[model samples]
Target: MSHAFDLALCALILGAAVLAVTGRNVFGAIVFYVVYGVLLALAWLILGAVDVALAEAAIGAGVTGVLLIGAWQGLADAGGLEDEAPRPVFLRLAAVAGAGALGGLIALAVISLPGGDGLTLAVVDNQDRLELGNPVNAVLLGFRAYDTLLETLVLTAALAAVWSLTRTRVWGGVPGPGHVTRPDGVMASFGRLLPPAGLLVAVYLVWVGADAPGGAFQAGTVLAAVWILIVLSGLQDEPRLNSLPLRLMIIAGPAVFLGAGLAGAAAGAVMGYPDGHAKSVILVIEYALTLSIAATLALLIAGPARRAP
Candidate 1:
């Protein structure tokens, strides 16, 4: 029964992947990609890696799905879709050959490989001294915080790039609020309910990450949703470069993470994300990252909010 289920899941994944890559409609492709991700998550659960499964689902299906849909929406009205030509037959054949060759090489390498990935295993072996309940989160915050810090930079840069390409900030190209509505009416009431509710989910994910299946990135993404909702509803001005608080949060995570790494040398370690202060370092980094992500996302949706004339 389990084998049959796995086979079924694999078939579904393959179908989704094919449709995602081959669909003529960009939106359909994005939707298929999200479906592929969900199936991949189920596969991971069957493989006994719940945490990894969660990350894949959250980042792949949830975050990336949102990003792609927004991008498609922005591009939909541009009329460029009408201009694209189908690939030449030779070109399509060459692409298929190249992909098959690459897959074959990968399989060959796996068959010949004789060793295992070791860094995490080493961390787990010495985790008693690490004081981290979640070995994976500990490694992220303690041993590889530099990578996380740099990743946040990449996200910021990507947002900026998207802003540049679209000629506006928001990927979905949503127009600024059309008209002001009652602040005390239905929309405002819904907004009030979401803040606390979303914050609770975010905090729970962060705190439980120490021992369970959640962590900083997941929590940050969840928190960003709240900011996005408020911005979308036009209850607040789409915050712009004028917002000092938002600016600070935008840059704080990398500053704190880099500072901690440089400071670690004084204690004895010469690298960032050292073992001695992993949890504290991770918590601080996570909080900064969360703020930065939320602010960036909100600003992206707000696009450019010009000064009032």
Candidate 2:
């Protein structure tokens, strides 16, 4: 809150970012990357964008950190973590020069930007139309529902692409490898203990999103993390790629969202909600999306199928 604190936070953020980008150790880079994401989330909180902060903390830091660690594990398992080509001095210099130039340009652009409430007042003025107290929610699910729909579809498409990489022999198989741990081990213990809390938190985030800073993406990320933990800890295994229930959970969100858009078009404008029903519609979409996003994100991180169902 104070200038000193802000300065300290900024320094830490920059330091973490630098370490993430330049660290010689892959694991250390990943740890710093996660720290960088957390610091950025804190910066967002200081700027009063609680929604963005929540998103950054959950998706940006938490889920992404897990994903990176997974990739590292995979690489290590495959012997892909072996020594690589040495960095060329010229390339390093060029990268430094390019990054400096880009940073300078960004600074200049920000300094030149006009000071005004770009769309804040307009969004606020029409906020009541969506019947949502959270302006971010209103803007995302109401004013720009089409964009949100596209985002969900994109995520689904990404998961599809990941699945497409599976070998034909393992097409319908479970993703990633099996995990084995002692029943009383720490991982197994936490896997059993943490999921209940994560589920509660995820549900609360979705429920509070209507009037608060939480939403489908944040909840989905938490749900995905829980699922990942369960799998990694040997409490459960990743679902088969061709499982009917698994597929349904992956498609339910986008399917519902598109259906809502079609229903809106039949009644009137595409993606438009009927009078007095916007919040209900949005909530329905959010809940459906939460499930699909959780499934998709978890699968994406798990990578392609590796074993028979």
Candidate 3:
């Protein structure tokens, strides 16, 4: 029965992927893409990767869906979605061939992976030393802290790249399209009710991540969505790039993570915790990271600044 269920899910996922890629309308394609991400998240859950599933559902599907929809709207407003010349048939065929070959190579690599206890055994062996109940969290924030640090830096750099695309006149201006919603509208009312609940959930996710499936990234994504909702409903304005507090919030994650690493260095090893203080330090870093990640991701979806400071 489990094998049959898995087969059914795989079929659904593949079907969604096809619809996303081949849909005629851009809006339909984006919707289908979001559905595909949700299906992929379900696959992760079935594979017993709850953390991965949560991230995929929130960031990959939810946040990315908003970003793409916003981008599509922008392009439509700018008349950039007008019909364009079609690519040559030969070019299209060549592209498909290349993609197929790459996919085949990836499948081959997955099939070739060595069968054994693998990294799971190693993670379990050292999990007790880190004092983190969640091995995934331990690997991300403890064992492989440097890699995670670099990942945060990469997100910051991507935001910078998005900002660089702003027009010269709007450089360092307000981010996003600055949408305004009707005061009595459903969106505004929902926005008012949602943030408080969302904030509570985000905090809980970050706090519980120390021992559970939630984490900074998932919490951050939830917070970002709340901020986006508020801005879209016109309850608040998007912050200018030069806003001091906004800048601090955006950098808080990487800043705190780097600081923690340096603090660890004081104990003779970089990114290491002093004896008996591992959980405390990890919690602090996660909280700070949650704030920064939330800010950075919200701004990323908001796109480059459009209004002057």
Candidate 4:
């Protein structure tokens, strides 16, 4: 691509991002956010980063749009947080310039960074014996599984805090009422179909991450979005806790991850997942985490998780 083309596209993306962030109209902002993301994804593709483009498009443009709309819809149902007037034009212009300068400096720094050592490559080369293709996922879920494990804990903790604060009296609340307004003109038909399709894609991303540019976390987020949608849509109600299934689902991921880790340690290595069982274990752990996260987030959003009984 021509240099001018790249610069023009980047400008368009930055412009859209600015609008997304500063637009007074929530609906307009979300539309801009999606546009910004697609532009950013295109910029990455133009720069010869196809893998990054894939993720940016999937997570940034697609998932982020859904999430923002969901949150906005929730906010609207809750009467929205309050609105403020737009800034003066001069102030807005100054703000834009300052942001652009900051962005430029960061880009320069990136361009100037020195080449790094092959630390990651070295680990993958030495540990390729596991027959795992994507070292990054293995590293994220295996060697560093502890980090991912704790991340899940943090997610749960945040959810718990929200649930405690909300303290809903029932599954008693009307469906999507008092806090679940769908955006104007955003139909349920497409919304209903999108999650399942997105889910299939998420599974593919997870499976492909074993050999390509995807993984559990990415897949989890997408899958989680589907769950969030289903909950938000009232397809399947959020499971009330203390129930057998709920409790089991909550602990499922962490238990399996730690148990597998312990088994590996008992055999010989710390955090070692069975020599050839790594793939199986990783998928198992990922699935468990997804379920746990979905449940946790739903409960957090709903508050005082109610039993389906």
Highest TM-score: give the candidate number: 3
lDDT of 4 by residue, 166-192 (tens): 335543232223224354434445457
Models 1 onward score TM values of 0.83, 0.94, 0.94, 0.70
Model 2 lDDT per residue over 1-309, tens place: 599999999999999999998888789999999999999999999999999999999889988898899889988889877874558989989999999999999999988877797788899999898899999998889889999999999999998888889999989899887899999999999999999999999999998998989999999998998998999899888887888998999999999999999999999899999899988998999999999999999999999999977
Error of 4 at 250 (Å): 3.8
lDDT of 3: 0.90
Model 2 TM-score, all chains together:
0.94
Q: Where does model 3 exceed 4 Å of error?
A: 84-86
Per-candidate clashes come to 0, 0, 0, 1
Query: Measured by TM-score, how close is model 1 to the native structure?
Result: 0.83
Q: Residue 15 in model 3: shift from native, Å? A: 0.9
- Sorting all predicted structures by lDDT, with the top scorer first, yields 2, 3, 1, 4
The C-alpha stretches of model 1 lying farther than 4 A from their native spots are 101-120, 163-191, 272-277, 297-309
Per residue, candidate 1 scores C-alpha lDDT tens digits across 31-124 of 9999999999999889977777877887778778887786676576677566556788899899889999999999998778767864657888
What's the distance in Å from true for residue 127, model 4?
A: 5.0
Please provide the root mean square deviation of candidate 4 (C-alpha atoms, Å).
Answer: 5.3
Error of 2 at 130 (Å): 0.8
